[model samples]
Target: MDQTTARPETQHQSVTFAEGLTLDCGRHLGSLTIAYRTYGTLNPAKSNAILICHALTGDQYVAETNPETGKPGWWEQVVGPGRPVDTEKFFVICTNVLGGCMGTTGPRSQHDEHAGQPWGTDFPPVTINDMVRAQKRFIDHLEIGRLFAVVGGSMGGMQVLAWAALYPARVFAAVPVAAAAYHSAQNIAFHEIGRQAIAADPDFWAGRYWEHGVTPERGLAVARMTAHITYVSEAALTRKFGRKLQDTAQISALGDRFEVESYLQYQGSSFVRRFDANSYLTITRAMDLFDLSADYGGVLPSAFAGTKTRFLLVSFDSDWLFPTEQSRAIARALNHVAANVSFVEIKSDKGHDAFLLDEPDFHRTLRGFLAGCAEHAGLS
Candidate 1:
């Protein structure tokens, strides 16, 4: 987590599509590249694939030691040999999303149409559907006729839902954990605050800070701090840090020496080291624009009018960001369509981030659901 530490070079596994793709915004990216990592072997029938969609800040390292951070994969606890979404029995593929910094084609990637400079702000606006479409191209290239499962949390969960909606016949099971069918107003407000923080930094340079040979570290760090606060519950913050005071040497900019402030500062500093400011802006905006019901004339059930894809929607009790009520609403819509759906609101103190943590109940539910589907699919 050291800001001064030099991370190792990224060893990317990616494929380029020269045919390119047209974006939802009508912009065409010529020769798009998608970086991903696959764990477990693809079965001969190609029916064991399970796509892992990461959150806003997550990369493709779902079940291995991350080369850049040297840290264990994000979901290593729930995705190993005997875990919930066991890689030993499933071809687990995780991709750094379209506007991601971990080797995916994004705002920081060089513009093919431009004269080799990074796209920066010139990058065309993207939506959640665009991200799912991009992933579909990669899956088609891999010759996967259908994915056995699609799983994700937060923004990644949005992509999972989009995948099921756009290609219902392709996804046998869709798990959207700690996510909603649409971004809430408060969430959009939170994102705007972070975006303003980035823009307010003079170093942002209109999202072209790389051209100045400087990162908008201060702005990006503050933005991360803000978002991180939303990820955890107030009870968790109190339980972990209380009003505990940090040493005077670690006093914050506001002159407070609280332990929580120090922790958030550490998080922000570490995030800036691994994430791109423009990519953060791009992804958050995409999340804000996500409205799965918009395509169905605001009738949520109509979106899944005839979906055969089974759904498991997970929510955390303390997740104020995307509350259980939102998950319930989606479940109700799925029920209205008589689509196979199950919803579970996990009992956890860890707010919106409960899905990422080691929650036994959540894991049990996911495991049982996937196991049932695997049996139905005859994977066992």
Candidate 2:
């Protein structure tokens, strides 16, 4: 369960491709290992496959006990038998994305040609398109011709957009929850702050910390803490922690005086235990580089011109990170092209993390959307 170390094969299902992948940066990976988890049964026709992309820092333990954290799957609330994304009716496939630390070919993965040393920063700079390309290859490996749906939020939602735009014919329904077509300047600035924090750590070793017998956990933790703030709303934070003190007693200089401080500290510390610093650098770069509309001369509609895929875009009212306007822009683009698409702004106080939380309205919307799509797709 060491986040930066090689995880045993028993921890998850994986497949290695000898030819590897051609990354967006034009580097060729000789051997690719995709660690993934599948829930429910693939129908005989293989038409029920739903690729559930994970957000940043998430792994392939979608509906199982996470081997590293020993906690229920991140989406356990919505993706189980008799739940919203019912396993009884659909097959769910989640993979540890390229540039991730969890059993995938990433910064921590050994370079096949180089042998012992890890890829570290040498791992070819990955893009959102690159991540989706890897996922598409994995789906082909599973021998699934087309997917019933491609679903995700935040970073995962970016992947969903990439999937739909890159391979529209292969996706029957695309649900990008709490996502945008490109990285906003503010989001990029936040990510830059995180990267700076990691680099400032003396133990970072220019991202080659694996050779130094130490990890840049402090810097990584700080990055997590900073980013975690953007994941929730001020309203939610006030309701949960507010200005309450961690202890009623008078505190020392370095002591965590505020309850919020201690909470973020716990979050940061716990994150470093289950994540790798170098991989964090690699993945965030990928997220920051994502821009679905730039390829088509900044015309978002041109990207989906003549696309056959059905789209359902969801956003939370309080999600300033990937706000309602972003989703609306996408909706307008799809409308311009007369593509099948629906956009919704779910009422919630959870901010950007609303899709991952226990919001009944979000769950209902998802269930209803998928159900309607299933009927259209001839799913029983």
Candidate 3:
């Protein structure tokens, strides 16, 4: 495999895993490719690199315009030059995770052994650790010894934790925001509903939608609507819509009448335009299978035993989906293992999505944490 790095300014690049990658499920990919993006510059010492992982539905476009959406990056406000991540001073890298749809090897990507056909449902189920393993390969391709920091929110946060635990020496600092060490039963149930919604769509064609030249748009839309509700807080919904009708002063239509309903409908419609239904199933299953304790003989603290990686865990006050309790649980485990850790729960009604929003306190907390980490790493 060619081990050359993409140009520093490359917004999107692909790295082929020619030796193929074996997933946790015992499925071996004959060949794999990872799509990624980079920002800022890697200093002479190469100690200024930061890996920014994305959440469940997010792709590699971190602080640049998304070619697919024709819109500014999802985290543009928080990751540009001089922002919290400080791209000007730190080289930032974000990759579309395994089982993602954005130009990465996923259900939508072509299968090497089967020419002109996508893996679709045949794509093996993946776990958070598998995603991290693939990313480690990507970093090795760049010839970087260790990352200055690994930062992510939600599922991305899970990846951060995996990096710190599985490759402690390779990470100097780790930040897992709005994330949990394992998916809760309620979370798994919600995901199951979404997956079922997609499967039930006639167009899904038993995960062979690609062959049928049709997409499971309606099913995917419903799934997005359900997942979007979990991303935001109930308080936020009430504040933003407050049972207000979409248009008239009184109720009229039977479907999507309220403002919140209309908003959810728009979100669902927009999501299907960019996401693949089979990819959604694969990724959500991976998230649901994440269990740090399982790898450590049912002892969660043992997972972080003797770890030297500095840790910063953040949670939102209203993020009931992956609430403050989950972050506190991780903090307790880290403390038990004598790990260096700091945890904070920001006061916000934005819920799990607060990490992506323009929350002043969240930004300040992140900026301070990264600054301290950079100083400790001796990166001027």
Candidate 4:
């Protein structure tokens, strides 16, 4: 983990939607353009397609150069040519979500008409359903009638659930890691605090500051700092930093006067430089509002009713953001509906980020589940 040089930027191509399409947020986002990238070739039957949904801060640059920061793909460990995803066998596709700033249509993207400036504060509010709907359009545009599997973690996991609930027939299997059907109260509160931090910054200017050659860097940095703390476990922080001071002068401080504080500060600062503030606000809000039970008459099991898609839900022991109980709840509901589902609560001290990091146990479970999916799909 050398912090010397910056990562390489990932280039992306633009995709536009047809005219007269309305978004779920009650706004007309006409002539929408999205930035995305793809890997591997689709088989002649188009049945080897796999969709890799990205997390809140991720984009379509899976296993490719990151356009925002010139570096290897964020999930390169699991999504390359002979990796767990095995691009040699599956046509893996990843895209920037509709409300993301990485390349998809978001507050940072320019509106089609009306002076052709950045949408900024005028950007419509987006929901998880909206993102899934947009993805459906993208898949259709590619002539992919069905996906062999939909896999993701965190916010990406939420999209997997949305896809299963909204378009179950189109998905053969799903892998949702470290995610919940709905945002917990604690998670909602954390997101609200981050939103407040961003809004309080004078530079935010109601999310319209981008066009003015300004950004709410301080506010975004603070928000990232707060969220980063929750992504890792207390055990990890203790083992890695454990009150070890960066220098003698800093040790005299009252709180977090350790190497971890400095490390988190760097992570926070670097994040603001690469991500947009308004996009953060939009995506977090979408996560907060996601509730599969609401659409199923308050019956979580009903959400998966009549769905033939197999499910594999994984949770980390240290993941308080979406605890094991949340994963179990989803499993229980899927069982009630007689849907094929498997649940695994991995032993880890890495918290919610264990799925993204190199955890041997998590990888083993993922590999097994994917193998089973391949078998079921007859993709020998």
Best by TM-score: 2
lDDT of 3: 0.89
* Comparing 2 and 3 on TM-score, the stronger one: 2
For model 2, the superposed segments whose C-alpha errors exceed 4 Å read: 1-10, 248-253
Instruction: Give the per-residue lDDT digits (tens) of candidate 3, residues 1-380.
Output: 53322323333567888887898988887877788889999998889999999999998899998876676788987898999999999999998998888776888777767877888898888889999999998999888899999999999999999998899999999999999999999999999989999999999999999788999999999999999999899999999999886565465556767889888889999999888898899889989999898999989998899999999999999998999999999999999989999999999998888999989998999999999988889986
lDDT of 2: 0.90
Instruction: List model 1 lDDT by residue over 1-380, tens digit each.
Output: 00111113765777777787899999898867888889998999999999999999998899988887776799897787989999889999998899887887898888777775888987888899999999999899889998999999999899998999999999999999999999989999999989999999999999889889999999999999999999999999999999998667464578757889889999999988888988999999999999999988999999888999999999999999989998899899999999999999999999998899989999999999999999999999
Q: All candidates' lDDT scores?
A: 0.90, 0.90, 0.89, 0.85
Model 1's lDDT to the true fold? 0.90
- Provide the TM-score for each candidate, comma-separated: 0.96, 0.97, 0.96, 0.94
Q: Which residue runs of candidate 4 sit more than 4 Å off their true CA positions?
A: 1-11, 248-256
User: Model 1 clash tally?
Assistant: 0
Cα RMSD (Å) per model? 3.8, 2.5, 2.8, 4.5
- Which whole-number lDDT from 0 to 100 does residue 171 have in model 3? 97
RMSD of 4: 4.5
- For candidate 1, report its TM-score: 0.96
Which prediction has more favorable TM-score, 1 or 2?
2
Off by over 4 Å in 1: 1-8, 249-253
